[model samples]
Target: MSGEFGEEEQIEEQEGPAPSLAQIKHIILILSGKGGVGKSSVTTQAALTLCNMGYKVGVLDIDLTGPSLPRMFGLENRSIYQAAEGWLPVPVETNGVGSLSVISLGFLLGDRGNSVVWRGPKKTAMIKQFIKDVAWGQLDYLLIDTPPGTSDEHISIAEQLRFSEPDGAIVVTTPQSVATADVKKELNFCKKVALHILGVVENMSGFICPHCEECTNIFSSGGGLKLAEEFNVPYLGNVPIDPKFVELIENQTTADESLVESYGKSTLCPIFKDIMDKVLAQNRPARC
Candidate 1:
């Protein structure tokens, strides 16, 4: 009995400071097999959608190398200020609702073009600090944006949050074989680590032309659903590409209410909401 009790104590010690984010109800990760599949964009929009649903959300851009949340949320030139609690995350206002707070290595970069070159240990330490030191107050959901492909970053997150047992991970992929093949590897990674998979999200599933509104199979379609079927996981939903959305993020500002108005009307918006609808319906407990 003493030995078992001692082991429990050791685990408590290992969890360290802020072991389990008590204030945050659910923690979810957004991962992709490879980059440039709009993983970051999807993550940002999902966070916004959740916020619009009246949930307090926070986004941790763990893609340290290519942290884009600063720009994606139109928070460029913003800096992280120190609070009495810890490092305060930059807040993102979505449709006049600033229900989201965000943190990213991009905000720490000296310049837009600067690079982050770090060994595995350094990167792991940074992730640990982000989990421990950030002042992430009460939150309904904390969406983590992981770097492309599974590597040291993936291992660190899975093990670090082993106790927290993140609600699950959302795998993002394009409708192409090259991306789907890697997504399979990503799914295997989640399984090996015992992380529940909420579902698979197919981004840029199709493209709708602005002029004629004709749908185009630019990147092909159905690969994500097929992969989900093979793995027996839920297919969240698919988001179509719209030029207005491209301009929204590329412009790096949400001050454009017209752009915001147009973006909310974009094809991707509703598709993303449908994906979240599946998520909320299937995992009602995640909301708690």
Candidate 2:
């Protein structure tokens, strides 16, 4: 699968860790073997969980063709700014014990409807700029939300972070056999690149009824766990589809309340906390 993007590492010169990454203690990539498995949602909840735990966090959305973190974090209208260090990421109002900041091509595009139509070389260049140019300042964690599959952007990120010693990757997938099959390629990609697999998250394993709050196995559960076991990685946990969580992402809240704040009240918050706990247990300790 990765062979399709031949010599993608040569898109930019090999260098040390990006300037912004130097001050970051840990970096975790949110990845998937296929799309629409809620990878971005995992990244968002992870960041919010860490922030609520009192850790400073940054999120970089590298899904060039379909950047959606800005909308997920409810900062769609926000724009990036240039400072002496580099591009200043838009800050999320945590309104809690921690802080959250974000950088994404979504912020750079003036129009939400704009499409990023570019060749492999162009996409690689933009990804390089995103990795090297953003000024994240000091952060406890930087969660990179990547496009599904192993492609140009993935190659570029792997090349750039070669020296950064990233914490690892949290692979997201549904509890469907097909999703797990595609995700096997992703696990293989991690092994080939020597990137550590922190764990596997089974997102949308079931549907949580908004009325009764009972979880129903709409998609049939256990595929994600089977994949993790087959790959010899930790199975973080299963995440049920919650309507309130979707509302939290889509509904506009008051200025004093941020996504993180709103998430604290959601039923899924504890589920993600357990997943993050399993992740942090393997990496550097996060502040709480």
Candidate 3:
């Protein structure tokens, strides 16, 4: 029996093909032209929001050099397991919401500070393995958190997932002209890769005074919306500067229960809900 089983396995290994695309519904890459724009936060919240709305979601942190999704989803301690089949992603549960699977370079490297000093081809190969080797079951949305700017990792995802074409990409930026200016380049990069532009999300649009309830334009306002209008893309929404959000992220709080009770009345939650709605509306056709 053992000899026969081994022979069968060898034949299967030689004859079998890779997994089919029917397993995945959509692939959405979250991008930004520059860093310090809270693009990771947008990706995290978007995944959480989709899970909250009862959709199966997964996040792939392709930012090999500076992986942050593991920390953002509070899975820094968790690791991906390599089995005879493939790598297994760690699933993080959000209280009162659905769950999400996460895969990041952080799990592979033992040292957090170790830089990924690889060339474009090497980076592209690593990304391909991440997509093809990781077991991301059936997912409604597979959000790829890309490293900032137009680089090898970006090109790899755009090329490999070209068949999926992704539903679209969500660009994150601040409300400053400098940030919005680079967004055009990011958009152009997506167009060059034949990926659709879902919309732009302006993070830290304004600071809400926790004490006085007043809004202050810390980074200036309306640049993201204006850019969206000029590009003829939907304006997703803005995320205000919330000190509690900082604390929530730092503390690794994934529960939507406390967050809804605490900041549900604030503009951030509403705007995020609106963004989720827009994403859902856009995702419907792909879903069907």
TM per candidate: 0.89, 0.92, 0.86
Report the number of clashing residue pairs per model: 0, 0, 0
lDDT of 1 at 177: 92
Candidates in order: C-alpha RMSD to true structure: 5.8, 2.8, 9.9
Name the 10 consecutive residues with the lowest summed lDDT in model 1: 7-16
Clash list (residue pairs), candidate 1:
none
Ten consecutive residues with minimal summed lDDT in candidate 2? 7-16
lDDT by residue (112-223, candidate 2, tens digit) is 9989898778988888798888898899999999998887888888888887788899999999898898899999989878898999999988886768978788878999
lDDT of 3 by residue, 1-288 (tens): 257446211111112223633466777888899798988888877776677677788888999888998788777767899877689889875555655889998988877777778887788889879877988778888888988888778777765675554688899989999888888889988776667888898999889888898999999999889989998989888888878766776654655544323344444566788997987787445632
Tell me the whole-model lDDT of each prediction, alpha carbons only. 0.81, 0.87, 0.77
Tell me the tens digit of each residue's lDDT in model 1 across 1-288: 157446211211245325437788888899887888887888888887788777889999888888988888878778898888898999865556538889999888878899999988899899888888889888998999998877878877776787775789889999999999999999988887778999998888888777797899799999999999999999998877767676767764535563334456665678778888888776536433
Residue 211 lDDT, candidate 2, scale 0-100: 80
